[model samples]
Target: MDPDSVSTDNILLPRNIEIIDSKIVNLSIILFISGYISKVEISKFSHFRELYLLYIPYKFKLLLRGSRDGFTPRKFHESCDNVSNTLTFIKVKGTEEIVGGYNPLRWESSSSWGKTNDSFIFSLKNNDINNAIISDIENSTYALNYYSRNGPRFGNDINIENPNSQNENYNRIFCKKHHYKKKIRDSEEDFSIEDYEVFQIIKC
Candidate 1:
């Protein structure tokens, strides 16, 4: 299995939805709110910034995991069934909507990917499923860059990440409610979903 780098040959007009809540602190009430702090009513601070290919892996994994119960891979894909393959779980709706990019401006690739996730599977025995997951991530991301329409070529833009931006208000509240309780600051470990002891926000 050959790992492909970001393809420079195509029209890499890659855009990302980019969410803020880097980690869940309290219950979903407040989130970390990536990039900047909120100045307004926190709840109304919803801003979506369109970033080019930056630390995409970091941003993407954070955004992906933040929505999970505890950022666990299984939690990310609820549609996975107990399959007989070497890799038991699969990303059921992994391809759908690419969702949230519903803005009438950019081209939506997520919808197409969601449609493809069903067919995309990596058998651990055949090609190292973990590796495949990584590959798929890259492939999916790279594929996003190629999508071009209406001469302008838009990326699947959406509101996420920034709190002050008119789009990610809810996310800001989610971050403040979920700040890392331990405050164990180390350069090596920033403490992600796995570090958080509690799964559900309120232990209902």
Candidate 2:
């Protein structure tokens, strides 16, 4: 079936939401957070199409397996479900905040991506690239570390809880574990979210 010919009637959109742009590409994801929404254009980046095609064959097989299988953590295991080597866009509530990161490797429950030190995270307001704050990640462990959880810890953003700090909104892309553990430790910085959406990054 032609993508352009597909109907979006089944696609859920919140009431009272303004349509930003009607132009549609191969993969356009509209993420709604607290009634506000943002779009992620798959064609804007690079190399997403090739990766997505690679997933198609596997996806057919996965569907077959799922028919026989009873359960799986499909939501949490984004990469395992076929969104490998993708960028996750997270939109948070308040101050037009957005925070997200890229996972360069496929997520597997058995391997945990094997100490991927190259992974990174970034922050932006109103989806403005000029106002973006890109940070190289120091750690990329699961939200749980058996003893202590570790994810992307930002600067001045304390991992430990502090009553005095005012930045209470926690916007993080946690992998396979709890979102409350790993933190971005920038006190002066704040990217809090009420909710978010995850899309498979595919470059056109």
Candidate 3:
């Protein structure tokens, strides 16, 4: 389906499926056409999308993919720096865990922190959305960290490091509870990632 053609007015639902809310139906169509989410994962992403839409209607556009664009801090900043309202997804290596965060401020290649109350870190359950955990910013002062040597960092809770490392599987990623309300991952140990993606959220 063409993403440009997606709208609440044109979306046709099956007769068997009851339309409870038009916003969710519209969000499902947009998420499906983006191809970043599968049919099974649409519901999970739809809820996340709705939260953003509550303030302003936004469309997610793919900015970077670790496997496709290279998993370096240089590569991440090249495509994502100066872009505001981005959603990042990291697929943990050797596991089904998907951890990510939403940055409402522009990313820069400088050593500084971006403060925002809307930013959040989360872990999406691969099969069940109910088990997913979302951690809101407990300390707004350290909501986001923009470091020249790191990819992305959500407070002191989660960070992607190793700008000097040549190996993609290097143990550079770390997740722990710090400035966030709760931990997204059960373990606070540093881990490698299978792949990661970043999407720019544009107001529609």
RMSD of each: 21.8, 13.1, 9.3
Residue-by-residue lDDT tens digits, candidate 1, 17-130? 332333322211222211111221223222212122222222212213333433332232232212111111211122211111101112232223211111111111122212
Model 1, poorest ten-residue lDDT window?
96-105
**Off by more than 4 A, model 3:** 1-56, 163-170
TM-score of 1: 0.15
Between 1 and 3, whose TM-score is larger?
A: 3
Which residue ranges in model 2 land beyond 4 Å of their true spot? Answer: 1-74, 78-82, 110-113, 139-185, 188-192
Distance from true position, residue 68, model 3, in Å? 0.4
- Per-residue lDDT for 36-115 in model 3, tens only? 32222333444445443343345667888877878877788889999998878788878777788888799997788999
Consecutive 10-residue window with the lowest summed lDDT within model 3: 17-26
Model 2 Cα displacement at 147 (Å)? Answer: 12
Point to the candidate with the largest TM-score: 3
List where candidate 1 sits over 4 angstroms from the true fold: 1-68, 79-141, 144-204
Give the Cα lDDT of each candidate: 0.20, 0.34, 0.70
TM-score of 2: 0.39
